[model samples]
Target chain A: MTLLVVHSRLGKHRFEVAKGLSVREALDITALRVRAACGGTGACGACVIHLVGGEVSAPTVAEYMKLGSDERAAGARLACQVRLKGDTEIRLDRPAPPSPWKSIPLENLKPLTHGLPELRAHTLGVAIDLGTTQIRVSLLDRRSGRRIATRRGPNPQGVFGADILNRLEAARANPAHAAELAKLVRTAILRAVRDILARDIGEVKAMLAEIGQVFIVGNTAMLALLGGRGADTLLDPANWQGAIDCRPHDVTPWRAKGALPCAELVMPDPVAGFVGSDLVADLLATGLTEGPAGALLLDIGTNTEIALWDGATLHVTSVAGGPAFEGSGIRHGMAAEPGAIDSVCSVENHYRWRTIGGGAPQGFCGSGLVDAIALLLADGRLKPSGRFASPPGPDGYPLDPNHPNTAITGPDIDAFQRAKAATAAAMSQLLIQAGMTWRELRRLCVCGAFGRTLHLGHAQAIGLLPAVHPGLIELHAEAALAGCEQALLSPGGVQCFDALTAKTKTINLSLLPGYEDRYIEHLRLRPIALTPTTGQRP
Target chain B: MLDRFIKAYNEAVFETDKEAAFTAVNTALAEGIPPEDIVFKIVIPAVEEMMSNITKDPDANLAQHFMTAQIAAEVTEKMLEKFEHPPEIIGRVVIGTAHGDLHSLGKRIVMGCLKALMVEATDLGVNVPAEKFVDEAIARDAQVIAMSAMMVHTATGEDGACKVRQILKERGLEQRFKLIVGGAPYRYDTELYQAVGADSWAPDGVNAARAIINLIQQVKHRDSAQDI
Candidate 1:
């Protein structure tokens, strides 16, 4: 046994662990929260800790790659890679205030479904928007058919992998990790439910006796991880035959044993391919599927999902947008939160910015990055080829000179470019395949917490979104959650989703002709040329 | 005449002038300096020099090397155009990035090198299924099938090298075409390449063309021996 002390802004704690256990394992045992974003693959260096005392194993190759010589000399080691050789004292840094992207506001949410009398008396309905990085939960009062309380928290699986690809890779590497990821998500949901109900395990269990239903909306990868299904097909792109198991699972047992009560937990069936029920929910919430056709729905995240309704059938595809949109891999990038720069503009050769809560800038969020890139391109500071004109400072362009900490690194710009290119490519491929022009689409519906704060002009300027009629662009915040709420409230909407899925044709963009040319063409951060469609309806 | 042509080719490459390099090759062809000799001696050496310089100096200008490769590819293409005998199609080959691997830079270079050698090469784009490689090979009557598995996770699947072999074995066409696998992942482990059922392996595009050519010859010799 070895005594180890960990110091953090959350305060210091001491632990005794068996010799040779990695620092990450020790932290996990003690329940000390730390980010191991690559799940101890050592690929993501989020688990860096300062070794203040005692002996530790030599830094792993990943640590050497991630940390500078000065950092290594200063006793910096990746916690996930360092196995304790002797009693050690380590320091953990405190993270910034939790980002607003963590929670979705359910204000002004109208009831889309009517209640069931028998179920209303006995059960409470819960709608969950299970995101890759964060989980948002909304509790519904069965009697009034109104949303009562909403709770949000980091998905515990985040420690394993920050992005879906990493998670899928982690699952492929170890079956046990796959099972653990699913268990962690279910546990997090239970924890969120308890927090929302403000009740103990016993009380929550008792309340479960009257459970109406639960709806989980997330990407296919998230659903597979939650539903405990083999996700090998999602990881291997070639293995994808354009079919996904859309059958909803009854996951009540996942939380039932943990002291929460749930009679039935129904995850809506996933859309074909990697587009999950979330898009199905997006379609329902945006009313895109209900209409006389020609509307596109794009929910941008780590994996940007784009759907185009061509009147008769739905065309859907997911682009490998990477984790830039979630602010995961960038140096000083973070989710939308207090102290996070939400927007950027250049005036008189100086960059100006706005923070989420107007505090000192800690980092740039997704929206701020989009705005910054657009502004940088507008000037000659950044090129359409995704290169900085002047040699970048240590962390590239600082949004504000006073706040050196809030800056976009050269690598950050590259990541942002790749993400935008993916989104643009998917949109173009979807439109081209459907034989529809941007003018033909009656409305372009953007949904997601990230989409809510996105500057439409900057997005269009960067070619992240096509140049469409300004009046036709609609933003729906937390539409996935709203879709889940609709599913829970109305049985009819669930049937509608079934019909939509039947008509939905998932297109593998790689298989399409001119896909490569279109993708390469859109890689440049330039607007798509819009032809004159004077007679087109806006 | 040969020495003068070599000097001109070297000068054109050093200056990174594609037009000058192409003209130098044209002059060499007009002087009766064999196209294959120019390719093996001048073009390959220039590309090899650039690669070695890059290795020796980490910060070496990559644009020069890319320009040289581009010029070499163009010169070979142009030389092929002027050939009277159509440079007897050495062999037909199909190449692509294996399933789950989307990287294309290496594949593009390798395909260019193969095309430069006057081999009929069909390129299936990145993220190609293993079946597509076999299907294309069968359709084109290709003598070699080369696949790049850039990432460790994407190198071999039941549908990749293994699947390619399975399809060949089922059709009893195992001796018809040679299989060569290249990429960063399989470079260090030749044994792993064999385990994945590849006939041979190359580290990158720089050496892949030579490996594929040799593998095809070996397959041809083996078929002749079996027939005898």
Candidate 2:
């Protein structure tokens, strides 16, 4: 008999359960942090968790490849992989946000050049980036994914709330909010079309003269809300059953049916409701998504999403990292907009960072966060365990509310540490599942738009990424949108995507024992290393 | 006490607080504190705080923020309020959120800073439809009509400062008001202000307040030259 401590993040509740029982069974005992991505199959690694100390319960080969030497050394193990052997701790890092693979479309890929059988070309193809605070729609030439024109505006839906859950919960709270969200999205599209074509607001005919198809990608709940499907309908995987329950993706959900007279709504094939089409498209863009060869795609954003593509299988997981990195969590936070501190440095454990648009930075965003955390880790400003070490150097100082310059405080570091831990843990889970050692990972791909701006060396040094020797990691430019482009470009691209999706076996890592202790160990921001320039953080 | 710190507050020194205002009035009543001090310190800072809170939450209601605004508005009814208040040092500014646009964190921060040292702030809370802007300007005899918007769609659309100018032009009050804009909307194009007929722009509410103050000082300098 083994003891797996299942602790709830919201409440101080923990449940000890027997070994070999699935996390699905544990869900009955404790509604803990694990949000099953693969529908509890050892298939989607989203059920991936951090293993604390215990007898090595062992994960599927797919689960072993996502881990790093440090994680495994720290007693971290995937939840979906190992059965509970003895007294063990298991917990998820903050809910992983959707770190959609940075899938930017190729310049010429499009879904419609007017032809093809069984194609829903009239579906007004649009790939929407439904940001937590802003709604930006890119009207693809679906024929080319060339993004004929892009339109963005503040999410009028934010009038009701911010974040998808907020918008969804708002609709749940008041039906009108649902209607309002729909109205806002369409109005934005209408306004976008008119402005782009320089035509009348209602002139959809003129706007579509050159357009022939449509596809949309957003948070799963958002697509559901847009389709006028309520929460019950939204959460029911049976409605999304083809993608989750069965290995093969059913194209039926994207049949372009909706309550509103809007463009055809193409739902990105979602993993779990949390890891939806954006991520699927993201996975597509990342190239070489799953199998035992072992490659991990970590994207940090409003929702941090990670996927382990082993040579033989793909383990995908997500944690709700929240708005902390995107400049929404802290006071004075902003997006990667002008006046945002997108990059920060260590002034010998103090803090000095640069703004995106420059000027006295109003606040920090994701890039700045990476810089801050990595810098702190290198300079001993933070501990290897992600705790604020309060670098006893001259540059070390406490975070002050009144002083705008006091950017990364002890508390902010913890937020970053937790975020980094979740990310590293997910990656670790993939390596462990693959059964391929970190050195054997063959290649590590940093997948994200933000990943492009990251310092690779800094990432490794701080333990946010595996310590695989450089040259092994290949950063994919835009993995999610690339998949969207693929879906739009080749006639059989969607089917191809469906086939590729089927090949992926989502392994639920949460059910694996010893997840909690591993996550706790990875929480340290201070890496087991040192670098110069740790003294000038101002 | 109020009069003593007005200049420092404007210079961004010794941050301002509501208690400063109450202290001015309380001291004036308790001792032989001058009425000028009472007006400048206690009343002015208090009003600044009142106006600032309306935008602190971005989504907070105007009424929820500044119930004291009405009190300040009534107090301004006095003749001495003019000499004591001096709403022109930073300029006779008009500021508010755009129609159907309500997110006032920056707007109120600007209002608080400006009005703290006597910039007259006409704060219209979140989602003040376009029409009300025109009507209010005429009613208040405002100098600088500034508006804030945080939405990307509205930012590009004619909602905040753009609407203010159209209304001003329509009423033949163009020269009567100096048009201004700020908020999330202005990021795409600064020349957009000129394209949409705005006189000037600022990145945030604080900068917006500062810009108006600078413009007023320039205009004042010209006026003095003409008089000479």
Candidate 3:
């Protein structure tokens, strides 16, 4: 075994692995979550981590192909590409570009100053997280590619009803109402832009010049409908949706799709349709292909998706989970914003939490959800079946009997169960298909905002986590977003996306057998020891 | 006694006639029996018998579950229309889908239960706008905005109901209405509900009707306390 030092943002996470093992092998031994999409065959850029120090072997074709002309200068070598002949020091960083269109930070550099109009060195672009439950926007300087300002408020379109499907249907039936929605987006975006312009520097026109790109990252329907493309059918000409084109995936047609009119459209290349570009972008940003340790990546949303990497193959599946994380499904839930309840605690058999706004108590966020599950499990309030032993004492939290949002309902438990089942089933199926089990895997890295706040123990308590030892499970905070930032770290990150398509398999979950049964079995909030009481709960 | 009656009827009658179960439940309710008593005692037992029958034969031509749902809806409508607006203050609310909620049966059940509970309410139906919720609240001044989210995916209109609330704020009507969301796909986490910025929620009809009145009074009481 050769000693290797794995440097991460949190300091040194080191390991000693066999010299015959690739560089990715040592990092994998350490706490750094580096995965080789091509099973160390050096086919995917996902396993690309930097050799920060120490003399390592030469780069492999996968690493060489993944890096751009600029990144090669900074000692950026793929973890799998190099062989270890001596003691090596490496830094764990994501490999390749989200796409060539996205990684070009040089082209994106703009020099905008305080104030709109007239002229500025750069432009301040706004990126909106237009979710079904909540909408958030981050303002970035187009020149420096830095987020100088950020703002989040409730999406004004909520009044029409709740959820995107409802919104889409409404828009489809009423074109004028759809336009009104667009006007609202324009007004809101303009207001934020204007406020920045007014407080900072130039007038609207001058400020506009500073923005090199306006990347609108969101779930698909949001981009489609908000861009006024919601009603577009395949047969329409000029299926224009008022788009603002930017090359995302860097595919030739992706660049052309940017030309197809959408309401301030940009690159949606990574993921679209029901899954949305946010997830696909997050996947690219996080680089799931780096791991072959039989890891699972789950991004929870209105539609929860799970993907598994089995050393040699990748399998993906989606489950119908609610907008629980966004706070829409809960009685008093809010977005993970300033006033939302981001964390929860259970003391003396009762649940308590600090709200986001930090005032009177309200609802929970994804983090709070983990804590709630933890607290509930600790107090024996929930079983794997997902039923609560009725909120403890008779002082009875004054719950709303009819309000499904305020109380734990069977369906609610069922939903959570299905979600867990989906994840567990996906994990199980992936492992089963790949001829292994989650327990057999050396490591399971949890990524995305949903997992960061979730307790691995609690997730397992509710059977959400696979039947693996707690020691094997680890959390990567904002791994996708962090991965996005990681993609930006060294030079040539944008141009390195070629390594992405080169290595990886997308396993569709529809083929799995025990999947449906596991899904049905998992549907019970608590594991059903006996037959579950369906109709109405007393 | 009620369960036995339902079981007997379902065995003797509904074995061949699929509609017999509904007829039996309706008959049980006509003798001044409570609806919960009807569901818990009669309907539930009858359903059990029907299921047993289906299991025993396996080839009995049972009408589709949705058809049964429609028939039940008709029965509920008939039962609800006969009440002629309860004289006492059971409670008053307006229930429906958001502007894009085309799924209406769940909303109907919500309405039926309110009527069953003798709570006076305006049935706003499905696919209502947030503006309509506001306008209707101002008009009917509804105590609770009871919304049944059938398709979990389509509960909220464009961006979901919260977007509507954001719209309400833009339109200067944030504090004017209270919101309550329910559906098969929904869960009850008060903070989750409030996180979406709604007043409250209920899981079932009995609880929902009572919760509506309770939340309404609480809001009014808080308002008066503030005024005082």
Best by lDDT: 1
Candidate 1 per-residue lDDT over residues A83-173, each given as its tens digit: 9999899998843233322223323244545664545355577888898987878777665676655666788888876767668777777
Off by over 4 Å in 1: A1-103, A106-119, A169-175, A199-205, A232-243, A246-252, A255-260, A393-395, A531-538, B1-92, B99-120, B125-144, B150-153, B162-228
- Pick the DockQ winner: 1
RMSD of each: 14.2, 22.5, 18.1
TM-score of chain B of 2: 0.60
Location of the lowest summed lDDT over 10 successive residues in candidate 2 chain A? A99-108
**Model 1, C-alpha of A306: deviation from truth (Å):** 1.0
In candidate 1, list every pair of residues with a backbone clash.
A100-A336, A100-A337, A122-A210, A123-A210, A123-A211
For candidate 3, lDDT tens digit of each residue in A281-396? 45555456665556666766666655666666555445555665555554455545434556666666545565432433455566666556555556666543343555322222
Query: What is model 3's DockQ versus the real complex?
Result: 0.04
Query: What's the lDDT for residue B99 in model 3?
Result: 52
Q: What DockQ does each listed candidate score? A: 0.09, 0.01, 0.04
Better of 1 and 2 by TM-score: 1
Please give, for every candidate in the order listed, the TM-score of chain B alone compared with the true chain B: 0.81, 0.60, 0.57
Per-residue alpha-carbon lDDT of model 2 for A401-495, expressed as tens digits? 34554355444554555566667655666556666445566666665435355667777766777777777777654455456655665576556
Q: TM-score of chain A for candidate 1?
A: 0.76
Report lDDT (CA) for all predictions: 0.72, 0.53, 0.50
